[model samples]
Target chain A: MKETWKELPIGCIIEEGGTSRKFKTGDWRSERAIFSKEKCTNCLLCYIYCPDDSIIMKNDKVVGIDYDFCKGCGICAKICKAKAIEMKPER
Target chain B: MPMKALTGNEAMAEAMRQINPDVVAAYPITPATEVVQLFANFVADGRVDTEFVAVESEHSALSACIGAAAAGGRVMTSTSSQGLALMHEMLYIAAALRLPIVICGINRSLSAPINIHCDHSDTMGSRESGWMHIFAEESQEAYDSIFQAIKIAERAYLPMIVSTDGFIISHCMQRIDMLEDKEVQDFIGECKPHHSLLLTDKPYTVGPLSLQDYYFEHKRQEIEAMMQVAPIIDEVGKEFGDKFGRHYGLFEEYKLDDADNIIMAAGSAAGTAKVAVDEARDKGIKAGLLRIRVMRPFPYKQIQKVLKDKMIISVLDRSDSMSTMGGPLFIETRAALYDTETHPPICDYIYGLGGREIDVENILSVFEKGEIYKKKGVEKKLAFIGVRE
Candidate 1:
């Protein structure tokens, strides 16, 4: 059962900060970004340009996309001069 | 208590001096300018330790107030007419956030032809904005009600608008007994807030984007809080009365019992109605007045009980809804009496728009018409008192 209004905090105030991680905004995306490793130079442009900051990095090198926070805005793909990030239908 | 001669605006500022909130963010407007201006002086002179922010506009004023209140500070502000209309968006946010910010709301006419005068249009237009309303008839009520408003708003965690008529009360001087600063401070104890943005150990997020999934539940909390404010208002009013010797209730009923004719009104017009009722009574006419002090958690059940079996009833409104039905007070009063056994002819009157002159004789004319209707209740009619039509 869902929590009632009384069970929730007063004044629409959520009692915690940094809750976006748990809420995960990527579910509403109509498109998803796929990392193309062969064409990628790992220049870190996509990492810096991801609108949702969903670009995954291991040791300062881009490894993949964290799809949880990405809403597929295509910002990372557009900003990637290497054409390493591609947007496709989420199916 | 020593009596001090003060205008409605001065009375409000004096109350602010006594409460001395942590923050006051406001933009000045007609009739209400003196309230903030006076408080700014108090801050300048170092009499009170309040952070007075001279905001650019009414919207910014209320936004600053919301920010301060969410940060665990007692906040206040004052505005009128277009200023209030400008702050409409933040009014919903402040109430939705449950910030107990008290406002010295000077009632004035909204601009169409750009008129600056006494009218209920400003506050009445904001009736549905999730704030408590307290209408004052004169300077004394304006002074006394602010102290009670602070307690009530803080207790219920809702915003409050304690309003006085534009120039009618805000400019005119009246003698009102005042409690000393210590007495006033004792009446309203130290401000203890439950939550704050600065409390880093336990963090919180305010004004989050709540969509269809949980927006309905948040609104349900507001609905219950609004309903819960009625008893809090009553208890606070009685406590203020006991401490300050000025008893208050949800509404003031003057000579309601054993009377056949009743005139219902609020704000400054209610004072004129009282004099008219007395004159009518002197001439063997059984006329009474129901002065509604609190308009928000509208005392519907109490009003219904007081108005039962009355033969002639007329509801006076200072502002028109332009709906052709009636003004705000007239609409609510009619609804309150809907299920009562006695179906009294509740006439509707819109008067004093844009500070139009209305006195005892003009009000007596309405009562005299009530005398004729008292013989046998007639069809309910909508009429304008001072407007040339």
Candidate 2:
């Protein structure tokens, strides 16, 4: 990006809020969270523990993880009681 | 225009009554307290619809003003001496945030001896706080500058400090040609903030943490905005003059044409110096006076033009800079004249500090010294006038 005052925002006033969603932090992750539907007990503990709200649910049933917004912090794997979620190194 | 005798503080309160800002968050300080007090009385009497917040301290007063201004409301406040000192940190924040908050700073001396008298030290100390500083010579100018300040502040999107010498002008009563409420309201119009916090449709953050990435750019933008102030002031002054028949400029030149020696000063002392200049003119000494109405943005080019032809000039500063060189106005005037082709011998005089009485004779003595300096070159760059030693 060109570093000049004209390129900068006027008065540094950010026009939008909650814009962090546009930045996919998943690129920063070395490992990604994988979900096993069969081994899952729909306790929603991982949903409550996920920092990035990456846990996905379908029809009120625990489905899989949304990696678009997830940073793969392994919080879901650490919080899962049924070991339904696993942390695997990204290929 | 209706004429009424009023003190400087009363005149400011009357202006507030006419403008009737949305929010006035202020604390009570000597000389300036009367301004807020009278406005508060107006608030009590239902004369104006304003949320008058009696803040705990000057810091909270300015903080509340910032919040109100950020929320897209017309905001104002008043302070003096130590009170202004207390609002120092928030002053920078308000200016950096670019909130058009109009502040009435009754100029008083800062502490150490703890004086409550008239001086320019209070506002002079905040020169670089990124606020436009306008000094008023009398109650009439003080009253009128408030209205002009509101328009200037809104147009420039920068904060403004309208100052009157404490007790000298603030407490002294004078006949002020007052404007009608309808005229003032129409002239000032409504407060249309550029970026308000209350704009839910376009959510934005104020006072955000920029760090090193964008802080410098934001400050650069602020400097660019400040550079527009001189022209904006001229435009607003002309509009005001056309409407009300009172013209203003960056500074006021009194009989400067064809004058050999000139005295440069600001605030109420300028009024006293003008009388001395007239006396000198009558005696054919060719003395003139230049009162700097606007201090910040310094008016470098305009001042250099006015002083370029003069042979001798003495800048009287009511406040000391403690810089060992000279006072604030002296330093600024010297710097302004540095690039000019005509090198007039300019001297600095530290005078009228701590509300010390400076009569016509005191000013006349300064002019006499300027004459002597013009003939036999200045031995000292700076001298103290009205001091015991």
Candidate 3:
């Protein structure tokens, strides 16, 4: 982020796409999602519902959660029908 | 150049035809309808390559202009009174987005009984909307201002409003010296926009949500751009004068040199005031007139330099501020003179509301009052001319 007016873009226009990725929002989370691959139904429900696109997928199968971008909103845990995803307090 | 008798609306339309802008999205309203009506006729006849959008309402009209302008299209629009009032929110949006959209606001009084006439209430109400404003005194100036506005707006990367009194200038016909289409085209050149939405290689968002963290900084940038416009106006005006022979400035000083008493005004009222100034000069009252052509980026230093030595100054405002402090012009003029060393006793006169006629006699009385104020100091801070008690 530009600290001064001289360095700021004209009209504060954002020039680049996905600029939100620069700010690590995952640090804002107090809770983390734990994904169990063995118990998962591979429905990709968590992948589809992750607001931050934090759900990691490989070959259309839910693998894990990318904690770098997640704010731990817990929507994945709430939507998991097979009780595969669990929200855990950060240690 | 060719001289032709044209109404203010026709003059503005002819200017638009000559400039040949990319888009003109406007809705119809009283007093301002003919401007767009005539331009639409030009579009239909294939005289100009303008995409004329006859939107459903004034709100949509401005909204479409915003969209088109953001896409790097040179746009123009016209409206008056309620039409302008409806586009109020979008007015700020257009400026904040920094699109070089040129608008011709036919000034009219606001509602209560809903009157359509010549008044500055519409433009005055939008004084703080972050758009550069220029007022036209007659059809000739109205025609000339359109080209100047295009150059100024594009250069500053800001929106501009070229206003003329509704009905008084919009509907009345006057002889106007028009520039040839090629001359206007070459003078204005092409609309070169900065940070357009249509640039595929460099994708960017416009009018984005800027929270508290960055909104202030964005506003600061806008302020800087607006400040730069004052000098740009003079530069463009000088260049236009060099090529076209008719010069423009922040304000016109009519026999202001060596004058003790002067009346500062804008729009067509200045024309009436000039006649009064001449009448006062004949009687050796040492009276003069200062006609403010550019309102926004208000010529603070220029006004101070012109009126600093004067003994008495009367600011004529066509619309009342309703704050009991006269009107916008009066308030601005007072504020501009606040820091001056002389601090001349300035009075404000509110007149010509709702199409009220202001003849030479009415303006002459104000000049006479200025003479009295120079001798006796100011008796009243605010007074209404040609108004019943």
Candidate 3 residue lDDT tens string, B128-175: 889999999988998998999999999998999998999889989999
Report lDDT (CA) for all predictions. 0.91, 0.90, 0.90
Error of 1 at B9 (Å): 0.6
TM-score, per-candidate, Cα-based: 0.98, 0.87, 0.91
What DockQ score does model 3 reach against the true complex? 0.46
TM-score of predicted structure 1? 0.98
Q: Rank the candidates by lDDT, best first.
A: 1, 3, 2
Candidate 2: share of reference interface contacts reproduced:
0.54
Candidate number that wins on TM-score, 1 or 2: 1
**For this target, which candidate reaches the highest DockQ against the unseen true structure?**
1
- Structure candidate 2, residue pairs in collision: none
Say what the RMSD of model 3 is.
2.7
Please tell me which predicted candidate would have the highest TM-score against the true structure: 1
List where candidate 1 sits over 4 angstroms from the true fold: none
Report the C-alpha lDDT of model 3 over A1-74, residue by residue, as the tens digit. 55676677775568765577676678889999999989999998888899999999888888899998888899
DockQ scores for all predicted structures: 0.77, 0.39, 0.46
Task: Identify the CAPRI category of the predicted complex in candidate 2.
Answer: acceptable
